[model samples]
Target: MSHSPVHPQLRLYFENPVGRLLEHPDGYLVVQYNAGKRKLEELKTFLTQASTLLQQRNWHKLLGDQRVMAAFTEAERVWITENWLTRSTTAHPYYGAVLLAHDVFARLAMNLVMNEARESGLVYRLFEDENAAVAWLLQVP
Candidate 1:
């Protein structure tokens, strides 16, 4: 995924979307959408990756970089709170640091995720850069 993602038409290609789920050498997962908007399937795929990693490694920290990601639909947000959060991992993430895009729509989308997730007992903080995100992850809550 590119550090920044932008497009005029926002066309999506299903066979090879710009989304990526990668593990950082620092021992955390970093999920990114390098281009176009994220549909429900893409979002679920990423969440599945996180769940699988957590099941194996049991880490409760992850960096969700949505700088290149697009805004999410309301139903998508609800899906996360309902299904993903409930069945994600044995050691569900309590502290999440997110890197958001400069776009207001994307920022608001993330805000909704973080806020509504509180109802499910997940707390995530937004960050403009990776350094601050990792720093917050290291700090004890």
Candidate 2:
């Protein structure tokens, strides 16, 4: 989908079949994914694009909204754990938010993954609301 300018310095768009990215006024990047059981190639392509953008812009904040990633095959979970979560450390955004809203099992799983991601030196939070997510991303030091 096309990216629309949401604010003077913010851009928002759907990155792929299952994810959206919001680049914010203060150099923050938010990437949201919801594709379940998607192929590893697809996830890599999508995340690679996002990583390129993040590197190009040097965004200070990154939000990953996986609220819709409700279920996953075993392979999918392993891919996410090994690829997405770990690879996030390479880009190194100052803040990261993993959004969750439904599916108790998925929420719990993501929470654990996020905790591990936090050890990589990025501030991370989990939220169930878009407003809260935005607030966390925009929070000033």
Q: Which ten-residue region of model 2 has the weakest summed lDDT?
A: 1-10
Give the Å error, residue 127, model 2. 1.2
lDDT of each: 0.68, 0.66
Best by lDDT: 1
The regions of model 2 sitting more than 4 angstroms off are 1-14, 90-93
lDDT of 1 by residue, 39-97 (tens): 78867776776677756766677777777677777878788878877774344446678
User: What lDDT tens digits, residue by residue, belong to model 2 across residues 1-141?
Assistant: 222224566576446665667676667677766645566677678777776777788765776666666555456556666776666675445577667746777777766666666775557787777778878777844
Per-residue error (Å), model 2, residue 58? 0.6
Q: Which predicted model would earn the best TM-score? A: 1
Angstrom error at residue 125, model 1: 0.8
Poorest stretch of ten by lDDT in candidate 1: 6-15
Model 2 scores a C-alpha lDDT of 0.66
